[model samples]
Target: MNFWNRALIIILSLCFLLPVFAADKPNILILGEDAAGDSVPRSSRVFKRVLDALINQMHDKGFDVYDEAVLTLLENNSSHIRRTDSEIIEVARASKRPPIDVVVIFQIYASTQNLEFNTRINTLLMGRLLNVKTGKHLGNFEIDSGKNFTGPAQCQQECILTIVGDKSRILANDLGAVLAEKLVWMNNGDVSEPSKNNKMVTEYALIFDGFNAKEYMAIEEYLVIFSGYTRHRPIEIRHTRSEIWYQSSIGTAKLDRNLNKMLAELDMQSIINFEGNTFTVKRITFRNKEIKENNEVW
Candidate 1:
């Protein structure tokens, strides 16, 4: 009777702790940058508005989002913005700033054409998400809007400005929805936030080979699905072949073995071998038999 009572107490305690553990929301950083390669402030303004809209959307979806401007000011004591992926990730890794799980890079640009009686303007927004720990690009998205104003030439410029702002907000909301879905997928799966003792975790170097384009894509799909389970980054990738090198926290040999089993279950012929802190993968086939035969004739 005492053992049964103790077991019940442990179960109840875990049930209570689980919710608290899951409530630790992931931090996301949104960085806006110039893309026009000019002094024009249009790109900056559009990006700012889009960032604001994305933040609101993420907040509603229960995410903790930070703006680049605020982060820079707080960490660097300046309001300067970083424009590239490396720069953005560098900021996230700084000890002074709050830990970030994901980084969203956003850029906007516009083009205009003047006509005999009207004007046409097109604006585009491009965004991509990166894992802060692995430096892996999870996904990318783009949205564009075009408008034509056939009016008393004077008001044409005003119309274009209004359209730019409106479309920027719409694009931002759509992008946010897509990002939210990705986060939902991660949260529902084995992917967890970076460990607090990540630095203390041992490091491993891994190699994956024998993958063709089709098989590589298959592996990437699995990575995207199981990305939450491990924080690993590819150090080198051979685009024309089936090989990649990655660095990751140690003790992932079991994870790699599980992946090999999962691939075999999917009928992909691959084998993974692990040593102290290094592993290798070799695939039996480059592609499906039918696809290979069809390609051989070409």
Candidate 2:
């Protein structure tokens, strides 16, 4: 075969394979915690066993889990590897190893089976997912196993272990399924409507007074620099004044804070007032010159 034919074959082959390659498994970092908000140390046999089971479950659900052994190595090598969820996230984000896509914090606790019935035991499992890049919480999910397949009335050491094992397996599978669904929604541009725990995207409109055409253009430029808008065109220009509308994944209050910080560097003195979802801006000075204040409703 000639070079052209070979090149054409290669291109066609890559076209067929690229999609599969692009859909790589999500890399997740899992951390185990006991009820007291302390990291379950490596010596804890039960915590390690539960975590291992959870990792296996995650793998079964098509996720690429970072090895617990490797995490232990990191913890031993660095002082940053404590048990808190924040520290785990920090260490995972800073690590130069595999790029972590999601951080999973798992907490397990045992509770009384019932107030009246003291024979059985209840195991509760909770998991929270956090995005590695933004450190934003994606969502929280929970699972509980209550006296599944009762063996012993009062759970002693061995009985407790057996109950915890049963609960951990169920917890791991449930967490993986929930995380998978969340990932699917996120991949399909449904991040704004993710699980109830996350802050939903909000849209706001603002009316600017005394902002001339040049300043309006500058404001539009600054919104582009803000890089928080889901839509590319976030501002609307008008003859007398301009109206700006944008959507942010953060809450309205935080977005307002960021907008104020961005607006401070411009060569304009403006007062911003927020009423409900609408913002009104009045310009006191433009280009270092005081402007005649006007109470105009546009």
Candidate 3:
């Protein structure tokens, strides 16, 4: 091919590949929670309206939002599945769709006060941002809708509609901005330095079941050199179960892989499970005695 023809081919190939290699914006999923930290039904009118408002705000900020209806569909399709905050993670992990990077859990509280002339409606919106991949708490925000005076005969539902319609944008904007900034920092792996404490650390709960004292000691020795390990304190140590408060900069997923790999290397058959910031290690036994341990490590 001629020089100019070859140059044109190269330029066309670059154009086609650039978009594929571009960095994608993080995917966000918003969920509603109740006072007891349980998942609030999305069917509630208040929850639906507030969720729509938040979704609009996020969209305006150029974020890709996951439809909550997909979660409902997943639940309905699975007979044994019940939707909850923690269960959402497991469901997301099992699905083949794009992974959810951040989850926003929000709660809404509304109340009315009676006055001689009219009733005053007040609403409070509380939200928390969590990083799904690392199970890290990003931040929390609380926003209140200023007093809205309505007729004395105004019902709770009418009051909720009035206040939420008027203040939803404000609430969404405040929380959305914070969430956007935190997402950037998390994506860049930039954890803020501790102001009060001199060290940067995250606390995790570690539990071991069916391991002997000698095995526990060996595990501790390995932990001391684990990646991002700072320190740990033993809460309880027993043959049946043991607990330790571990401090590290790494997430539970990484820690789980590391511990399991160490166990295999030591010829200890075990199963490691993790939920959020807690990890549980259980020793497995086999009668054949010829079973092979997994050689894979992440």
Q: What is the number of backbone collisions in each predicted candidate, taken in the order shown? A: 1, 0, 0
Top candidate on lDDT is: 3
Q: Which residues of candidate 2, in runs, are more than 4 Å off?
A: 1-25, 35-43, 71-82, 113-118, 146-154, 189-298
Q: Rate the local accuracy (lDDT) of all candidates.
A: 0.60, 0.60, 0.64
| TM-score of candidate 2 on Cα atoms, chains taken together | 0.47
Question: Model 3, which residues run further than 4 Å from truth?
Answer: 1-24, 35-41, 71-84, 146-156, 188-298
TM-score of each: 0.49, 0.47, 0.47
Where's the lowest-lDDT run of ten residues in candidate 1?
13-22
Can you write out model 2's per-residue Cα lDDT over 147-256, one digit (the tens) per residue? Answer: 45344555566766666666666666777677656665655522322212454545567677777654666676766666455432223444447665554556667767
Extract clashing residue pairs from model 2: none
TM-score result, candidate 3: 0.47
Candidate 1, pairs of clashing residues? 191-228
Q: Score residue 235 of candidate 2 by CA lDDT.
A: 39
